[model samples]
Target: MSAETASTRLAEIHSRIARAAQIADRRPDDVTLIAVSKTHDAESIQPLIDAGQRVFGENRVQEAAAKWPALKAATPDIRLHLVGQLQSNKAADAVALFDAIHSVDRLSLVAALAKAMAESGKRPDCFIQVNIGDEPQKGGVAVRELPALLAEARAAGLPIVGLMAVPPVGVDPAPYFALLAKLGREVGLTELSIGMSDDFEVAVTIGATHVRVGTALFGARA
Candidate 1:
């Protein structure tokens, strides 16, 4: 897409977000729009950045590691987030690149992240991913198990910052989002990563600090 076209599209997307936020009875600024630019080439995002987007989300560490360095080398201030399931084996690279990791679910990953932090002399903010839906295949801890996980993460000085979740495939997400907020507050977590293209408005209304928007902003992935 041409720069002009991308610029126009970005404007439209932002306007839609503003309208959605308004309709949801929230300030537009209260929701941070994280353009999920995974599977998208750097050229596709350059225009969005030109259109004033600074934060982007990537699902895998390798993909992000590849794209972020070049993007940062060019833009110098773009913030990258690892917003998908992260494995412990990739913890070191994740620690090196992402400004935040939004999917810290397992105790092993937490321990790996802490060790990586100690090794690198750097610590990135983390969110506890909760399996609010309780799906066996899901990549988060069960909701009832959150407090112990948070306690362990905190004890390790892991900079446990907030909570993140994906509601079950066929459930209303509002209650889950609210539950995350309540649990987050109980643990002094100030950040909540929820919502996507379809339900971001509900997320904003329920106090989501970050919404991972992929197709809504960038169009569907091939």
Candidate 2:
């Protein structure tokens, strides 16, 4: 997309976010918009960056490692987030590359991340992923196991900012978003990494601190 198109698309999403925040009586600035750039190459992403999008999300550490170093070197203030299911082996690289990680789902990964952070001294914010719908294929700590995992994550010195979740596909996501919010409060967390291109408005009203929007900003991915 051209810079003008990117700017217009970004403005529309921001307007939607502001409207949603207003309904919830919350400040729109509190909601970070992570333009998910997964699978999009640097050439495709630069237009959005030119349009003043400073925060972007990517799914794989290798993809981010390939593209973002050059991007960030040019635009030092750009923030990159890893919004994908991460492997324990990639913890160190993820720690080195991402400003935040939104998929802390298991004890082993938590351990890996803690060790990586301690070794590297880069404490990127972490959001514990909750399998809100109990989907067998999803990568989130089960609801019943959340407290223990969260407590362990704290003990391991991971900077636990909040919780993240994706409701089952094709379902009303309000209840799931609200449940994630309640769970976060119960754990004394304030940040939430819920919502995406589809339901971010509802997620905002339900108290999402970060929204990962892709297609809305970049157009349908090829």
Candidate 3:
């Protein structure tokens, strides 16, 4: 897309966010929209960066490793967020590539990340992922287990910055987002990464510090 087209679309997305914030009696600046660039090429993201989007999210570590190098070569200061499940083996690569990881869900992953951080000499900011829906198959820690998880990550000198969650597929997400915000406060955290393409407005209204939006920004992923 042309820079003009990208700028127009981004403006529209910002307008929607502004409107939603207004409806919730919020300042638009209170919410940071993280354009999810998981399946998108670096070509697709340049225009977005030119249009003044400074933050972007990626789902898979390897794809990010491939894309981010080129993207960063062009836009050196762009902030990269990892919003996907990360495996132990991939921890070093992820620590090297991402500025933040919003999917720290298990004790083992935490230990692996600590070891990787030591090896890489890079400490990526992290969020504790909460399985709020309590689905047996999901990839987050049980909500009740978060404090212990945060404690362990902190002891490793990781910047445990916030909490993240993916609400169950067809349900209302507001309550869950609110729960995260509450948990963040209880834990003295400053970030809450929640919501996505579908319910980001609700998240902003309920005090989400970051919202990961993909399809709404880039069209549906293949």
Instruction: Answer with 2 or 3, whichever has the higher TM-score.
Output: 2
Q: Output the TM-score of candidate 3.
A: 0.94
Residue-wise C-alpha lDDT for candidate 2, range 92-207, written one tens digit per residue: 99999999999999999999999999999999999999999999999999999999999999999999999999999999999999999999999999999999999999999999
User: Which scores better on lDDT, 1 or 3?
Assistant: 3
Error of 2 at 67 (Å): 0.6
Candidate 1: regions farther than 4 A off: 23-25
Lowest summed lDDT across 10 adjacent residues in model 2 is found at 1-10
Candidate 1 lDDT over residue span 1-42, tens digit each? 578876776677667667778876777887778889999988
Taken over the whole model, the C-alpha lDDT of each candidate is 0.86, 0.96, 0.88
State which candidate has the highest lDDT.
Answer: 2
Q: By summed lDDT, which 10 consecutive residues of candidate 1 come out lowest?
A: 8-17
Q: If the candidates were sorted by their TM-score against the true structure, best first, what order would they fall in?
A: 2, 3, 1
Q: Write the number of the candidate with greater TM-score, choosing between 1 and 3.
A: 3
Model 2: what TM-score?
Answer: 0.99
- Compute the lDDT of residue 46 as modeled in candidate 2: 98
Pairs that clash in candidate 3:
none
Q: Give the number of colliding residue pairs in candidate 2.
A: 0
